[model samples]
Target chain A: MVTVNGEQKNAAGQNLLAFLKTEGYEPERVVVERNLDIVPRDELEKVVLEDEDVVEVLRFVGGG
Target chain B: MEQERKLSKDADPEKDVQEGKSLPDQLQIEDPEEVKKQMQQILSKEELDRAFDARFPKEMQQKFRGARVAIAGLGGLGSNIAVMLARSGIGHLLLVDFDTVDVTNLNRQMYLVPHVGMPKTRAILQILYQVNPYLDYETVQAKVTPENVKELFGGYPIVCEAFDKPDQKAMLVRELLGQCPESTVVSGNGMAGVGDSNGIRTAKFGNRLYVCGDRTTDVGGGVGLTAPRVALCAAHEANKVLQLILQEDS
Candidate 1:
């Protein structure tokens, strides 16, 4: 079980990039944080999630 | 009792400064016209600054006196942010934009009809200086790319993200965070349409990136951009920058 944006979900065996795509976030538009540390854009595909790992995904909004 | 001296047309203004009296006082006029005439004197820059500083509380004025800020993109967000920072006496600003003002942009952007064809950098500079002549502006009319992000916005402690495209905003933020990891980047996202203005807010991404506006709101869902919401987001960005600057001194 992993916490994605405060919600408990099963992401124990998935890479960060796969999990983000499954969650409907575009890889280019979103920033991912793993366990309170920012995961660089290029490292998303390689970084994997473990049990009880925390992740936060944010995206930029344009208009102004 | 001292006798009143009669004023002459050729009175030596220098004599009043040498005397113990101020020049206006030395005019010794009961008529309003004479007082207006005496008040029309040139003031030195130091004297002008003293007058400008009189408007704000001493502590705030001191904090913003020499601090520098850089704003990227001079559309709705950047324009309002620039004006707010200038009014607060932030002292110096670096503005960058490659686009010109269009008639469509006048709806939400801080530009007049006459500025439709002018480059955004020039238009924003004119408006900012009009708001505060003491401000120092460094403007560049170039698009910000990932390759030149660090070079264009380096040296400034804080860089504001005011681009109108998601890809550009994301690219700049990613590059800025990677290159200038220590500097703060203020950005706006999700400020479209006109429902609850309160939906807009400021969110902190760790210690280096601060994003303002309704994170979920965008141009999708049949929504269109308006001035009220955009300006609110811009206000949040500008206000956050002020808070960050003041926080450093405290």
Candidate 2:
């Protein structure tokens, strides 16, 4: 199970970038954190998620 | 003496800047009467120091006194951020803006009716000085771009992004994160359109970027930005600045 934004999802062996696309998050707008460490934008594809990893996905919104 | 009293009473800051001269430029004239009048309008240095100490909390006063923060814009987010920081006793600020106050900005930006023609940087500083006379701040009337981003925000430990455009926000964050990795940046997104104020939140992204707002809302389909919501996000940014300042390691 992988926790994304506080909700658990079954993503035991998915690539971080693939998981983001599968979950409908825009790759450019979203920032990904794996297990409390930030995954830099360029390194998203190289990183893969394992079981019990907590992830947080955030994006920039359009106001001041 | 009577002439001095009349000149002091009749001195109007707005009228003094009639020739497109800035506030500081008007003060540079060597006229003794004008100098005396300007002196009477502002508090003495000793009074300003006393007011700063009395207006802020005694325990956290020193922390605020020593912290230097930069606000990257002077629109809705930047203006309110400056005001809140000033009232909270944050001692130093660096404000940057290339725009002047417009009538349209009155809805959300912190400008009064008479400030329509004034540069946003100058107008906001006027209001801030009234709130806390002892604040140490500098205003740069220029745009922040990738080339000048680091130069504008380089020294401050914390920089607040208040640009109205999404691309500008992204540019500043990217530049700061790369150039000044040790600096913390507080930015806003998705605070447009009236919804639950509770939806606005502060989240830490990467090591030094903290974003405030719901991260979803934008202005379109007749939905507009309002003051209450924008100010809430500004409060979050200001609070984060204060928190970082009070940090022992900061």
Candidate 3:
């Protein structure tokens, strides 16, 4: 079991993209910073999630 | 009083020196009176006038004094943005630049000869301080990276993306929107070496990201950036920042 945004979830050894899709979150609009390194937007699907991995997803808003 | 003066005049030179050294003991003897006298001297009319000038008119300057803005690059657009903000009385500014001033920068950077080889942050800060002594400024002497982007922009309410490199600008835009959701990020495009037709434009993408520059789709084709185009883009960005702080709907 791993924690994401303060909630405990089971990754069950699946890839990160599948888990995010299952969780109903879009990958394009959000950026993932995993373990202090930003996971580039282009490589969101290629990276796999490990057990107990901490992921912070942030979204952009429009402003001046 | 004449007799006492004569006695002091006749006193031994060594004894007079010793007694003069004990003046601090006399101060301790009547410390309360001494403190009252000191306080009275410290708070005189001239001192009060100086203090009032330093701190008065708070209501009139409150708006500009509360704004925190960050400039990503200290090149032509970044330099003009910083100067305009300082002159306009923006209270706090964060300037990030890792490049050193070079002879080539003189063409459009507005930097002087003395600033050559100096870090761009220090040069810009010195000019800003000269412009407005009360302006608050912070300098990041290194390049803005993904690791330190949040730290650099933690408290700033707005960021001006004046970076010259396309990849750096794209990364900054991504990081700012990702980390600082509440921050207003303005990006510039195609302000290089263009004429009047390639000046500046302000476009609102939704309600968060505002882009100001020439949208002529001719970026990085060896067309160098000039003063007029860069200054125009910076003015647009500055106006946008002011409007955001004033809560005027853009």
Candidate 4:
């Protein structure tokens, strides 16, 4: 099981970016943090997700 | 004869002659009136009052007497933010920047010509103290990373993210939210171009993170920033931080 934005789901064995895309999120609009370290925007395709990994995705919205 | 004798008796001629001789050729009594006149000629009380009121407010005049704020960068955004915070009475400031003050910084950064070769943190701290003698400041002459982020933050509640690089700014935001959830972080974006004054906006992401500046819409190819826009973004960030501190729903 992996937690993405507080919801738990089964590990799909896909890369982090693909997982997020399949989950209806846009890559350019958000920042992703896996565990504690920030996964840079360019490295989203290379970073693999594992079981029980907690991922936080933050999106840029209208803000000052 | 009677008038002459009366004048001689009352005058004390010998004593007056002796006193006159004892006095120096040029009497130089230190006259406070002369010094006061010189001072008035130099500066008026209204000017002094304006200078005092410009930096120190009645409520925050001494509020941050022992507080410490660590600024992570000293570029266009960092330099302006640091100086404004120091002037607003943040007591102790810890400035962190590995870059040196460059000529380009002069266009937007408030640092002067003499700070060219000096480290950004040191140069900005010196200028900050010059603006307000009441400020106490320190410097970290390196970049902020995950290794030193905790140590750098040092329990400070507010952090202004002024880094130009997107990755560095995102990294700091990630570190703060994950490691120090209680800390409030303010960030700026799309402030590098020309736009109307109304372009600047402040928005709250959640309870903790607030971002200020023009959104990416204003980041068209040729938009260049001036001091007014940068200062406006920083002011919005600082105002949001103040709101967070006061527990206001911003």
Candidate 5:
């Protein structure tokens, strides 16, 4: 189980892009940090999650 | 100070009495001397600064004057945020925006009717100057991109992200946090709609970021984006900047 925002989840096998979609977060509106390192926006599809990995997903909603 | 009566030093009271000039002393409702006194006292910049410093606590007045902050996107959020910070007598402000003041922006933004066609940076600076003429302002009339964000805001210790689109906001937050390690960013996320005003708040994250909004309301969702809600969120963002500045010593 990988941790997403300090919570354990069965997301180790999923790629970052797919995990963001399944969690209902718009990929364009979020910045992901995998194991304390920022995963650049263009490289979200290439990064694969691993067990015991800690991820922090920060989402920005629409509006000013 | 209202200019009700004309100040004519050369008028002859004797000639007016003979010619039946009707503007007598008893004809005015307000005290003419009081009005003259109010009009005569023009505040110099030092006096204005003193008046402003009286409102701020003693320990933080110098910090407010020395603080330098940058704001991106001069729409509802950035315009109002600039006004607040300028009023507090901030020393320097780097204003960035690529749009002109439109008729639609008058309802929520700080621009006036005559400022419709002017660039947002210039129009907002005019208002900020009136708020505090002592402030030093640097304007860049260009759009913010991920590639240029760091170059534009690298020197500012604090940056405010006030973009309208979610993607643009995310891009700014990501770029700043990634490129400028010393910069602290305050952003407005979801401040549309007339929801509970209390729902709008400043949420601090990981010491470098503070977002002020409900974080759920979307402008496109059609709940409505009113001036009061947007200004409330701006106040939260401005206050967070002030709070960060105040706590820098601690």
Candidate 6:
């Protein structure tokens, strides 16, 4: 199971860009980190999610 | 207190298990619902377990009653999560915290008037006893540093990270993930501020990680942590803990 934005989903074998598109992300300006390393914009289509990957889509939101 | 077992440490698990194994004996008793409804002020350990077990499916209850979970930090998130876990009949809990309860914490954390100066571990134990007296709990009142985080939380099958600060949460999550591969960490991340109550949620991260709360709402960022949101996040963590227990091998 690959975890994306803290939620585990069947994203292991997914292409990062395709996965993000399926998840309703516009892909204009989103920062995605897989295994704590940033995946560059061009690499989103090339990066295939592995079972051991931890992907977090960081966004700017206010805290409590 | 540095550390101690509270309330039910004296509870004889051998006898409790023996009595619980006699499942057929419960079938023999007539008016099970009435008996369960009438069960107030539990007098014996057997009655206590029976009342607690009545609401759960026998197999699920057995799994819940046999599991041990740990909560680190024991403040708003940890304290509330511990109480909810005990309510679910988790067999044992390892609670660790070094801070003392203050008037400020009464707003969101689980602490009473007299518990103001009491150590968080002791106060949480006092509250847990009130919720489930038959449940076993081991408490430690000490700061969890990177050096000792693994040793403190390694034995638990499910470890909940409920600290207040980002650094503490980061350190605990990082250490537990890297060092304690055997434990699943259910953490509370963005439950600060009273924004949208519905925004708080539980999500599984990776294989052995679950983080609850809105992933972005943080404390000290023009807002503050409140009771309803924090407790809601705590309940999410507690629910995830129970799910992890019942969903083993699923």
Q: Candidates' TM-scores?
A: 0.81, 0.72, 0.62, 0.65, 0.84, 0.69
Q: Candidate 3 on B186-243: residue-level lDDT in tens?
A: 8776566656744567877534677787654334555666676678878888888777
What's the true lDDT of residue B232 in model 3?
81
For all predictions in the order shown, the interface RMSD in Å is 1.7, 2.9, 8.2, 5.6, 1.2, 7.1
User: Each predicted complex: what DockQ?
Assistant: 0.51, 0.48, 0.03, 0.10, 0.69, 0.11
Instruction: Encode model 3's per-residue lDDT on A1-63: one tens digit a residue.
Output: 766766778874777677778887666544456654566766677878778787765432111
Which ten contiguous residues of candidate 4 chain B have the minimum total lDDT? B20-29
Candidate achieving higher DockQ, 3 or 5: 5
Tens digits of per-residue lDDT, candidate 4, A1-64, equal: 8888788978547799898898887676566878856676668899889988988776543211
lDDT leaderboard ranking: 5, 1, 2, 6, 3, 4
What TM-score between 0 and 1 does chain B of candidate 1 receive?
0.79
lDDT of 4 by residue, B118-209 (tens): 78876775566445544466778987886788888748777777776655666777677656655777877656655666887887655567
Quick one: best TM-score, which candidate?
A: 5
lDDT of 6 at B152: 93
Report the lDDT of model 2 for residue A21.
93
How high is the CA lDDT of each candidate model?
Answer: 0.81, 0.80, 0.70, 0.67, 0.84, 0.77
Which lDDT tens digits does candidate 5 get at residues B1-250? 8765654996655666654323334322233233333322433577876786678786788888889999999999999999999887778999999999999898789988868888998787667755665668889999898789889999789999998899999899888888888899999989888999999988876558888999889988987678999999999999999988888778
Tens digits of per-residue lDDT, candidate 1, B38-136, equal 433433447657876788778878788778899999988999899999878898899999999999898888887767888888777666655655557
Candidate with the larger TM-score of 1 and 6: 1
Q: After superposition, how far is residue A22 of candidate 2 from its true place, in Å?
A: 7.3
Candidate 2 chain B: 10-residue stretch with minimal lDDT: B25-34
Residue-level lDDT of model 2, residues B17-95, one tens digit each, is 6464234544333333444345435656577667767766676888887889999999889999999998877878999
Q: What is residue B98's positional error in candidate 4, in angstroms?
A: 0.8
lDDT of 5 at B51: 84
DockQ-best of 4 and 5? 5
**Candidates by TM-score, descending order:** 5, 1, 2, 6, 4, 3
